[model samples]
Target: MTDLDAETEFLGEWGRFQQQTFFLLCLTVIPNAFTALSIVFVADTPPHRCLVPAHVNLSAAWRNSSIPLEEDSHGGGPRPSRCSRYRLGDIRNFSDGGLLPGVDVNLSTVATEGCVDGWEYDRTTYDSTISSEWNLVCDEGWKKPMSSSVVFCGYLLGALVSGQVADRFGRKIVLVVSIGAHSVFATILAFSSSWTMFCVIYFIVALAHTSRTGSAFVLGTEILSTRVRKIFSTVGGNMFFCVGYMLLPLAAFFIRGWRMLLLALALPSFLLLTLWWCVTESPRWLLSQGRAEEAEAIVRDAAKKNQIEPPAVIFGPSHNECKPERRKAHNICDLLRTRNIRWISLTLWVIWNTLTVAYYALSLNTSNVHGNKYLNCFLSAAVEIPAYILSWIMFRWCSRRRSLFSTLFMGGLFLLLTLLVPANLVHVAVALEMMGKFAVTTAFSIMYAYTVEVYPTVLRNTALGACSMASRIGSIVAPYAIYLRSYSISLPYILIGSLTVLSGLLSLLLPESNGMPLPDTITHMQDFPGCCKKTPYKLTQTEENEPAAEGKCPVVS
Candidate 1:
């Protein structure tokens, strides 16, 4: 065990203070879940057709027949064209002569034109969406995906900045400020008059949202003991996010308007700001900053809540004397300075990027599925419950590498199975998609704990932030990947599945960290057990003979 863990062992694991912090910190993720994937419902493009002007007088039958039939890109055979309509002048002349369209003139021979006036949307599913409000269809369809990409662009910036800020300041300050900022920006986004304005405000909201999420995860992990960290990281953290995910469809189902739904999602973030008083600053972070007195005060308070007597000297002489060394500033470059850490960082970047692409692609593709969009989205979020539970079980007993590899492989296999399911069995295809969601969700939950264990406390938040920034590249690509469904229905699934399996194969090279103590410094990092041999540090004969120097190497094996 690390010296810090040994010093704080008197409070026991799962005390009142730890339990309260875990619950409150996990609550912060709910708003993040709402804002992260709200684009699916906000920008949904419903069925639409060209508008027939009232000036061209015609019977209801003739007006209904104005649009020509075209082959459905989703494989439902010929359907009414969404972007074009029969030349209204010709149709009007035919109606005046009392001749019908298929009876006298062939629609195949009739010339078609783009919607000259405007478009009319089918409001059966959504009463109003950004696509319907701003007419983001036909030639304007590219704007819809661009809006989602803008949010992720903000995520990229936030990840790069938040990590360094939190590591330099403290976790609690960042969490409070981010939560408040997100709530304010999200409220202003509801009043957007144009698509350009909405995108700008939405970008700021996403930046704050990402900051809030990363800070909460880091704070919760630092505050809790090692034994309890696994539970809080996997089940406690992600399950709340699942709750918000499930709640989104229910809120959208009732509101049916994009603006009001955004307001609903935004208003709840104010409630999370109350956490500033209830949550305590992380003691580990304080000690790392060379504030031993502040760290001791928090630890003693935790002990008081647990009803245990506090030790007279909580930090001891070793921690007090070594304060100068622990206070040194570390940056992102520090993650690449060492050999084992460099290998781990590069591998994690690939794994994070691949998982993000697959996860968001499956999530956003819910609208393209055969069932009701609301029900499909709800099922997708609901399946995460069992996935998280299974993740907790694996973290309790299984090796981190094996658990990540198996879950990712299973997720890819289920996605690939969708190709074999026949078009006639729509239910089977939906089931396979849900199974893929379940497996990927499990792997995602396990990844947070595994990443935390691999890095030292000093660079933990920075490493996570950098990895998150890299993952935004995948998120930016995910919407376009879903756009591939326009060409072939199975195309998105095939791409996401292939990448997921490849990532699972790469994860085998990461060192196992299931039961190891949290590394306090870069020198204490764990080595790759089977893939790479550890290089021992050179020492003098007298120093090597000492018990403290006997097994101490620059890098642990």
Candidate 2:
């Protein structure tokens, strides 16, 4: 749709406060979790744990440092102490002589404490200086990548299950409950005494954590006029990630412990609930559930708030969109019933997942920057703000095909640069990857808005939840990709770029929703394929209730 249509239909009709309030809430909600993805960064170590030249001795040190043991065990027995239990396999005892001729220090014992949660120890952590989480996960015989993959799996599972939970339980209730669940689980994650515990809690917090995502998207989409719907819903959704990426470095820079980091990240879920009191339910949702009276009440209040008078025209008992339907229980399959919706949702899922893969994979590799990692990480993330701005501008100025294609193209092009450049120019490589990140970030932001336009109102949340789940596929695979330096760098780039290109092409297959009334589900979308360019949308027999005026919902703004 043209800007004239956007302004005429959306800008003026939507009372400023209503639009602005939702926008503010969206921006506010994104920062906490988006920033937390970087939590794992503080726990990441460079391959081989690069030893810095700090002018320190290579000699080992006494791990447990019991003053009594020091006094009793040949005090200062002309032997160097073990410096760290980081290499538990290297634990040993020596008498100022070569460790007993045939002794296997590697076999002596597994240190019990101060280790990453993945591995179990037979004894206590012997050192205090280094990140035990890093060392412990690192020494897991090249399984670190696999361990990180668990987070991605958690992301997938969270997206799949939470859609029904949100629909069945109500968004407000889910949000309220998830706040507690997220904080408690995240806090418990800090006390993880074993790798098994860490893995389980990671999934738990991840599932609860996702509650904040799709529901917010649904709310943002529901509260907007059709013209501005794409921008409000999609850009708002993408902004969540942008806000998160920005905060990651702050956490990584200031917070170190995995537990403390999780707690900090989990706190926002609680805070968002308190602020939720200022908001209201999506009357459209209530109306769909056959609760017209309740829906009408909400609409009347919304009109009052916006200073618009509610109309008396009654919608019939047979209305579909924004009218009550005896809503059947929902599941993932419901999202695929319509051709346009199924394809579009699948595409969104694939695109976002691919972008996330490239993002987490390359972004986490920043430890190689070595000095001031916090600075490089933060600067890289800061670059994404422009990505959002660019997406906003392009989405307005260009077709979805052109806009999506260009964004994905740039991301791929830059990722290619990162691949082709010689390793000597490490800074250049990093710059290219940062640029790729920005491009994907821009695309990611745009896609969220794009998905809202594709599905109709009824299946909006379900389709979105499905797509969101798909996007997390990349996240699942990312850790293992960039983690292995021995693997060819070109491989990850090629994979991400190809997936993005495919997604861009997929956008061409979708009907343009520009200037069209927003759809509520697959059925609605199927009802009007061209969206308002060629034909007027006709109400289905059972679907038409009363000849109510358009924009006549009891709620205003």
Candidate 3:
């Protein structure tokens, strides 16, 4: 692949073609942000109470205050109970006597019953959300997060299925198909007549969403040279994702209704269909599939864009050298067959799970915090701009392991500090939580680049799929983790923070891949510096004396 990359004149380390491709692909990520985080608004549980029935014949004063005051499960002090309503028949006499509600009557003696007439929700924040529309409070409150979990389960399914499909077909085809599938399902989701239907359609949306995301990322990455890959991966790609995220609050602010918000999110997805005309398939992927002619044409076009002439023999022996060995076709089992790779794979799994859980938990819990849900979500998304910028900058100067470790450790430290901050200083606690979000976001950005560099090309996609599946598991569990807030406010933060710290320590075990060449085979992986013991390896005279290039693999002594 290094030789292949070097052979292409237009796939410059940093050139005009790369710039155009970077921005074009970055555009594809905006809708992704919408699809991923819309649940924050759609399932929002606004201030609500039981609906007082007209048949009760109570006065307006009693009707408004019919719901009893009770201690909140999350320690918000005394608030109107959401589920129970007083036996209106018993309380009607007091209300009809023209007495004040709670002050004049011993409301404490009134027996309570579950809400039989449904509920009334505060329309100040949202005109209608799924929670309000479906009465998903009290006994059904759990369903809110369940919808999000179902989507992640869809992500897990996509992770398992998309990689093989992409490999068997092509990155561009899977990407295009996934974009269409995502849009179609998402649009249909807006017309859902029941909670069950929304969840079902949402599952398909999640499946397609992950597929499109994986394909888009790989297609963009495969076409770039190592010198500029990180720039596109973090700044150009993930930064746009952040922008889409920031746009969500603004959209939610205006639309103010769940169905309208869904429509707003779906409308932009149609624009992505235009990408089929503009975006080209990865030349690298084409070459891997034995379609050398197609790959060469894409390269020539890129060279033309960059104002360079292709060599008559664009791909020489370097392109064909590894073809025979590569024909073996590796799978996930290869990651565990060798002892050293097994250790690396296991550690990477832990890091991936930790980052995903920490990231999703923080994002989902933002709505539950004591503030404007939209503002909190926007701030959370906005902070990522700097976090990503810092990650990109750090990757340039710091070793991969060092940057990853420090960010993960700092994220955990901030989350842990929230426990010590008093509840009265909620602003201080939120500030600390945002700081934690920032650190974890930085680490999340770094992990993608790190994972690619660590795995060999043969098993790279498969390993990434496996890692992605592990990440989906984290996302699936994140809602439950955040649900812990119902029992204790700090529990989710504590759990996420502790896991992040442990993952940071585990990351120390991975080899530094900052300037190493991309490994083409398992043998090449074993020879690179790693967690295993540094046993001196035998090398031929020619290999031992080979000089190293800046971004090429150095011969092992």
- What would the per-residue lDDT of candidate 3 be over residues 1-557, giving only the tens digit for each residue? 34566667445676688877778888888888877688999998988888887777888888877889999776769999889898877678778888888788878888888888898889999999989999888899899889889989998999888876776677788888899999889999999999999999999999998888878877787778876787876677889999899999999999999998998899778778887877888776666555567777888888888888777777643343333223556566777898888888878888888898999889988898878888999999999999999988887667888888999999999999999998799999999999999999999998887787776655666667777877898899988898898888889988999999988887777888776666655666643235434332344465434322222233110
Candidate 2 residues 284-373, lDDT tens each?
A: 566545565665565566666676665663333333343333245557786666665566556566677777777777576665443476
Considering lDDT, which of the candidate structures 1 and 2 is the better prediction for this target? 1
Task: Give candidate 2's error at residue 358 in angstroms.
Answer: 2.0
RMSD of 1: 3.5
Question: Which one wins by TM-score: 2 or 3?
Answer: 3
For each candidate, the alpha-carbon lDDT, in order, equals: 0.85, 0.58, 0.81
Report the poorest 10 consecutive residues by lDDT, candidate 2.
Answer: 65-74
Q: Clash pairs of candidate 1?
A: none
- In angstroms, how far off is 494's CA in candidate 3? 1.1
What does candidate 2 score on TM?
A: 0.75
Residue 243 accuracy (lDDT) in model 2: 68
| Off by more than 4 A, model 3 | 9-11, 93-105, 317-326, 526-557
